[model samples]
Target: MEVLIRPDADDAARTVAGIVHQALAEGVRTLGLATGSAPVGVYRELARRHRHEGLGFAGVDAFLLDEYVGLPPAHPQSLAEVIRRELAEHVDLDPARLHLPSGTAPDLFAEARRFERCLTEAGPLGLQILGIGVNGHIGFNEPGSSLASRTRLKTLTDDTRRDNARFFGSIDDVPRHVITQGLATIGEASHLVLIATGPHKARAVAAAVEGPLTATCPASVLQLHPHATVVVDELAASRLEQQAYYRCIARHKPARHRY
Candidate 1:
């Protein structure tokens, strides 16, 4: 795993956008996307590049990380609508190629199974962009989620719901469940890029990067991935015990290396 500590969130986003640009240059065709405050800057930076630098997503297939179970498709706060407004509308990515979990599927369980089957049948993701929850969860796979889990429905923890309440207006308004790609499902991606920021994320970042690989901190599953990059601002990297080493490693990385 590679840890990159940038000066601030915008800097980290730009650096991540560079990595995505390199992947696109290398012909990456499938992108796994995340939605949250942590990754919004990255999407915005990518959009800016698309508008000004000729960067494009015309041929890319985007797969969203998760969706709330009870939200309607048109709900403004729904992950689907969020991605559409924040990314799809701003990029050249074909709408027909974008895939999001069916939050309102009549058979939600079947829908989850179908999504996993379709993902694996299609092949590994070119890249998976991620955002770490304050509690160290990835997607909606909260603490205690099985390390080898697959796409499935999961109940949202109170902590997670509370964190997301800002978008829904109140804690009680937040969706209680969601459909998320599992850790094992996410692990199938050829590359994993996790973005996190702020002092509030420091402990989670440290636990993910330096703590033991355990389901207690679900994001720690990245440690088992062959290619994983953890991008964060200095504030988020504060709790990492090997902060100096991480900085030195990033500083010495070959200029041409993507991550």
Candidate 2:
């Protein structure tokens, strides 16, 4: 993984925004996307660019990494709606091109298979955006998840649900299961951009960037990707073994070294 330590979260977000714009210039349409706090800044940066920098997302296709099971698409806390409110609505994206995991499908297994088929038809994704869970889970691929797994329905760990509960009105309202793209599926993308920020993510970010390639910390699977960029802010890089190199990089870009 190529680690890029920015001055702060916003600088990291701008770096990601530049990558997104480059992808668009290359005629990219399908985006393997993720939902969570780490990526919030990225979405905000892209929205700002779309509005003030004369950028657009008219033909971009969005595919979420996962969605809570049993939640209606209209649910305010659903990934579908979150993406819509946070990013889609703010841009000129086509509604029909927005692909979300069907949380309430009658036959979930079939739906999972169909999701893969749709991806196949859409052609290879130009880039996949990811956010590392505290437990190192990527998408919903929890610890011990096989690297070869595909899109499927899986139970959400209590820790995961609790972490997500902040988005809902209460902990009781969060779903306990979800369908997500597997490690193998996400790793298949042409480019992988994993954004992590804040001190809370230090341990996980360290594992993803410098630890062994293991399923225990699923984000470590990023090590196997051909082209992966691990972007994190200074606080999140606190636990990294390469902190000195990161400090050196930041020193050169004083404007980006906010913290």
TM-score of 1: 0.98
Residue 172 in candidate 1, Cα distance off native in Å: 0.8
Backbone clashes, each candidate: 0, 0
Please give, for residues 138-238, the per-residue lDDT of candidate 1 as tens digits: 99999999999999999999999999998988999998989999999999999999999999999999999999999999999999999999999999998
**What shift in Å separates residue 99 of candidate 2 from its native position after superposition?**
1.1
| Candidate 2 lDDT over residue span 161-210, tens digit each | 78888888677998888889888889888999999889988999998888
Most accurate candidate by TM-score = 1
The global Cα lDDT (0 to 1) of model 2 is 0.85
Q: TM-score of each candidate?
A: 0.98, 0.93
Q: What lDDT score belongs to each candidate, Candidate 1 first?
A: 0.93, 0.85
- RMSD to truth, every model: 0.9, 3.0
Q: What is the Cα-based TM-score of model 2?
A: 0.93
lDDT of 1 at 145: 99
